[model samples]
Target: MKNLKGKVALVTGATRGIGKGIAIGLGEAGATVYITGRTLEPSDENISGTLLETQQAVIDAGGVCIPVQVDHSDDEQVRLLFERIETEQKGQLDILVNNVFSGVKEIGNAFGQPFWKHDPSLWDAINNVGLRSHYIASVYAARLMNKRQQGLICTISSWGGLSYIFGAAYGVGKAACDRLASDMAVELKPDNITSVSLWPGIVGTEEMFRFSEKWKTEDEKEPQNSTMRDYYNWETPLFTGRVIAALADQQNTMNLTGKVQIIAELAQRYNIVDENGNRPVSLRSLRFIVPSAIPALKKYPWLIPDLKIPWFVLQWTMLQSPKI
Candidate 1:
């Protein structure tokens, strides 16, 4: 459990949900965790949780916790955060989990709407904190990490980046995030710093639970209605956190630099399971997903052979292929 005992990490936007889970996972691994969020104290806010609450959770998980109230939108505040981390941890920042984003609400509100109908500000709403914030934080982390010539920068991205989900703003922002991690890794490789874009499939976060409300009373015949019934078969927020901890603990981390890591696959690589002690299905795994998604299929788990559409295969299109 103390595999990460001497490690120091920072998780941004960790007041609740995936951020909170990451902190806890790191804490459980015995890492000194610094958590940041706009909400400092417990509030009646609909989104719920706070930096203080997350701090306690980290401590309870057996990891040191430092809570900072920060608005990632403010570059100055972000700069101060890294400066403080450097000062306190003595220039030893082992991990940076870029988990902040402000556009979840906007995406939910305009889910079915087209790009033209959405306000232009939607782009700013999603990418400003999501993509831009990640870039800014990485710059600072790399600076400190380069001093020691080692560190990990993990961006929380999504499958939407590949195909499409939420809307243009969300997908564009995610795709950019993926690119940002890869490009940063390319430059930071010489500095011995690793940057990886992480994709957590169907996280059962607080916000996602709220999003699942509409499916509760839907028609049995509704299209894709049973996909996520209040996070059914979804990975818990802590799932990715565990995978991240393993990534940091691994001696071969540099081998994975500049790559987009799927949490489910990483979980398998690390032999980790969700809080429920079940392996979360990969987005591309037909064998596991079928049984996990439908109750009736659970009886015949082995009927579907293990099969996955690899990332290259999933994205390889006519345009990407060599025109014969």
Candidate 2:
């Protein structure tokens, strides 16, 4: 990784999971990272990890860390956080990772529960902290980046946006994240700033490992349980972080703006392996017999009409049906 000794980065929700990993990655590359989350102290039990812990971890990795307590759902707090960054860092902001997310806590182990059955507040829980918070952070980040005429804004999204993974709210929020990055890139392009949505395949975060263990014990009788068990090729949160760090160091980051990149594929390109020294399988490679086959079919005009009906019908049904 290129030295980021003087670069400044802010990673929202850096208390745990992907956000924590990314903050650490940036820090490891010598960036002065501002780690933000609601959990300020190590004793805070509201979440699994605390900002102080993540800050310490980053410091241990030979990087500077400034932990900040901010409720990302609060717009004023976010604005004030950026204002402080501007004041402290002399208006230089190099990178922003919009990774705060909620609402999955409400879903719990009921992965396939009908959307309507879920509490209506579930939508607000997701959009408020996940989607809207990202936009709010970006608004402030854009202002800071525009001053320097350079920066990278990465939204940690997933393949869930492209295909149904969990439920309606989660999928919609992720889809919006991708669209946000694409649209933001269009506006930021003139200033040489890049915005991208990253899809990290089945990351084995601490929460996910706990969920996997629970699924194995409780849902062993189900066929989907076997599939879940077989999902061992999970990437570490740091894998995506490493990719982002590498991308930030690239000379031609503008070339990748407005794109949705698959971490697994990028890992192959960047020669990045998980902490366990394993390469995670890309979903496209695993689920499709020939990953490029569907796109190849687009070349044939005769195949278009045949594909359109089933595709349209499936989409219509997905829209009408209650996603659990």
Candidate 3:
């Protein structure tokens, strides 16, 4: 725990998965968290989690939680969300976590298919609510933060931005997300607001389990494929959230602005472990990723110490990435 007693945070898409976990994690650090999502209560659909549930979980984690229902695709609703927060928190918005993305189902449907095979609308499906929405939310948050001349805006991105993890639409959206943070930081830095993209290692979230199964099925079809789709050694959603909480509470937040921060590395920096007392694997840690991908080598993972790939080497993904 980082000290965040009087901070006010807004985490969008907090009904489930990462958004929910981040809200709870911020709550755990003693911030007054406001969670926004479409589902307010239990629904008839198979998808689990609701704002009511996330609110209770956040409260249980030892912070105040307020739930708001909003359809992010609507600009009016998004505007109202910030207005309400300003009214409730009295012009004080300390942190913003943009975690809303409705493209999972679209990606699931188009998994492994080439870019040409996908409909042009695929871009809208992913970026409209994800990449574009993040910018909108940042606009509102920045306004509040600007008034105070201080704030933190964290965009949950992925390694997919550097390498091809999912598909074209996803890769493009994620890459743009990183760029958004980098560019935003350039403008916000003078005001003392921190902005950056965060890349979490394979997060062990409920939806991720379902998403990885898509990979398993695809990997089965191509036994020779080099890509790995296992989540056995991935980080918990809360761990990623915890990293963001730590990011917000940092004394010199400007030092980390304008770049993509890896959640795994931040975990080590902050000495954070999941609630189960386990440290999640890092992509560069050959020991962890290698064993997680090839279960046969699982037992040997602990033998190797934690080491990260150099930034220059990790950035060279064009040749290494599959040319599909």
Candidate 4:
């Protein structure tokens, strides 16, 4: 891996989930990471991770970290955050990871609801946090990176974004984000600031753990007996974190600029694996399978199908697609 000892990174939503993992991973590789989040701390419940935890992890990994609290939904707050980075870091920024998100419950609940029955507020929340936040942050980062003439900006999107994933609002927001990255790449490529959107395939975060527990059946009792749960647990947010680290350390990262990358692809390139160092499974090819299986996938009532293409074809097609 290339050494990024003096580089600087900013990760929004760094307080939890994949964002935190990426931030720590970058820090581990010697990048000075700035971690941001909406809420600093929750007084109630088991909120085990915080931006502070991310910072500590970086420190433990022999890297530097700074935690900042900001609500990406607020334009003014985001502006201030960028300004602080500019002034404090002297206008030097290398990696910008946009991973802020919220309103999960509202969107998830809208899965089966008809379009007309959907709440506008839920859409608003998802758009603000999911779409607008990414755009605004990218705009600001592009401005800064353009001046410096080099940077890497990665937006966090999801497989569900490209197709129907129960929650149309959230999925569409992510889809838009993917396009945003491509558009940004077109504009920023000349400036040497590579912009890309990427997804962490089937991450097993705390929230996912909770969700899987709920997704299981009390009467089925298979979760209690089988090791199926372990499959999903194969990769954690940390896996993607290390991938970001490798990306930051890449010597010719600009060569692959302006694309929507998936975690599985990166893992393969860098030989990154699950916590146990095993090559975790990736759903990159599912996009193809999903489109063709739409009827069956929906009728069978498996996880929401997010693509219209067949899984095998999707993977092959993506690989053959022209890279800009």
Candidate 5:
């Protein structure tokens, strides 16, 4: 494993999915991981990942993980979370991953609509979780990292940020986040702080599995269960997790600063595979395109229409869907 033995790392949205995977990956490599989320309970639909489970996973992998609950959308809460980290962990933060997200309201909306017709609250929600939260967390992380004069800050971004998708708020939110990473990298470079945006190709998460189950019930014709072929095709959260571990182990890691790297490319460079030990390929490479699906969309072929407006939105929704 990468020699993060005495290092400390914080991962937002670490209760489950990609965040959880990365947290566990870091832990497996011997780092003390702080898992942050909105809440600890499963009733909080906005926060489905459980901190306890993440901590246990890390311990089982022979490392330490501390679960901390915080709503990044709230400035005070964000500050407090970092304060606790400083007090409990104390000046040992080596890696910071901003993977927190809460945009459930946009689950089934039509992306072709104009910004004026969209829900105002959804825009605020997206901006809060997707963009602003990243900034707040990064600001605090940079402050601490500057003191050490060396650290890595990786922000999870999507391909949508690179292309035009739909809805001003969603698209703009990702675009701004991409810039945030780049701008932070530029200013913090002299401090030996590496900041960059990394993309998770197409993760099949718990949300994806739930969406698939619900979609299957709505329509019997749609195959809710994945065949072995489908299983090998999509990106798994672990693939990105392993890629992150590799990045954390890089010799000239700063050379990648400020760049928005695709997870597919990273996997190739590092040879990351899924839990099954098979390489996970991107949809485009597999000659497939997923949609911004609802719980029932998978059962009905009609719901599989192309969602090309803001690429990240579709990726987010697809990844958020329950992955069986």
Candidate 6:
């Protein structure tokens, strides 16, 4: 990827996981990155990482890092965050990564649970931070990008948006994220700003590794019951970050605006590899999933038939059911 020297970037939820990885990647490429998260100190024990940790990682990677403690769920905090950036950077924001997400902690192992069985409050957990926060951040980002008439807004979405991977709330939130990028691109296009949703296939973050280890332990008791094997081929968070940085550096990025891109395919095109120096497989290839014409189909549901299949059959075939 081309160097991001002299660029200014804002990465939300940078305390841990994919957000942290992306912040580090941008910093390594020589961008001054402002990272935001709820966790202020590395000593905070509630989460696996803190903003201070990510800030240090970015600085260690040879980029200037500004750590901010902002809860994305709070509209006031989000607004203030942008104000600070605008004042400090003089309206020169180059990249805005909408990576903040919540509610996963509440989901636990309820990936396959029916919607009714889960807590109703889970909807707020997912949408409030993931969907609503993205929109709020984009509003401020658009203003900053419009000032310079060039910028990239990337939302870290998932395959779950295209197909059912987890339960209803997760899928809904991700799907909204995809749509958010698409719609935002429409308005931002005239200003030379691009908004895109990126889907990473099975990232091996610290949280995911913990989940994998538990599944591995369960697999010992019943060999066929575990799904941990698939995670072995997972991509590192930095891989997606590389893709984002490359996209921002591309001159023709406007052409890709409003598209939902798969990280593995982008990696192949850009010659990107994970931390282990291996190409990650696309989730579409693994599950025989294909990108759906969601917006178009939503307006015309009569185009396809909706069939209710047994859960076991759905799992065995890896075929996603129609959303209708």
Against the true structure, whose lDDT is highest?
1
Candidate 6 TM-score to native:
0.84
Give the per-residue lDDT digits (tens) of candidate 3, residues 144-193. 99999999999989877877767888998999999999999999999999
Error of 4 at 166 (Å): 3.7
TM-score of every candidate: 0.92, 0.85, 0.93, 0.82, 0.78, 0.84
Best by TM-score: 3
> Which order, best to worst by TM-score?
3, 1, 2, 6, 4, 5
Candidate 5's residue-wise lDDT over 16-52, tens digit each? 7889889878888788889898667666365556788
What stretches of model 2 exceed 4 Å from their correct place? 44-46, 217-224, 287-324
Candidate 1, residues 1-324, lDDT tens digits: the string is 799999999999999999999999999999999999998996567548889999998888888999999999999999999999999999999999999988888877886679889789989998998899999999899899999988999999988778666777888899899999999989999988889999999888877877677555656553235665424458899999999998999986889998899999899889999888988767778755566556567556568765787767777741263110
Winner on lDDT between 1 and 2 is 1
Prediction 3 global C-alpha lDDT? 0.85
lDDT of the candidates, in the order given: 0.85, 0.79, 0.85, 0.74, 0.72, 0.79
Winner on lDDT (1 vs 3): 1
Better of 4 and 5 by lDDT: 4
Model 5: residue 229 alpha-carbon error in angstroms: 11
RMSD in angstroms between candidate 5 and the native structure over all alpha carbons: 7.4
Model 3 vs truth, CA RMSD: 2.3
RMSD for each of the candidates: 3.5, 6.7, 2.3, 6.9, 7.4, 8.5
The runs of at least 3 residues in candidate 1 whose Cα sits more than 4 Å from the true structure, single-residue gaps closed, are: 44-47, 215-223, 230-232, 288-295, 316-324
Q: Write the per-residue lDDT of candidate 6 for residues 105-201, one digit (tens) a residue.
A: 7666565468898778888977888889999999999999898999999998986775665678888899999999999999999999999999987
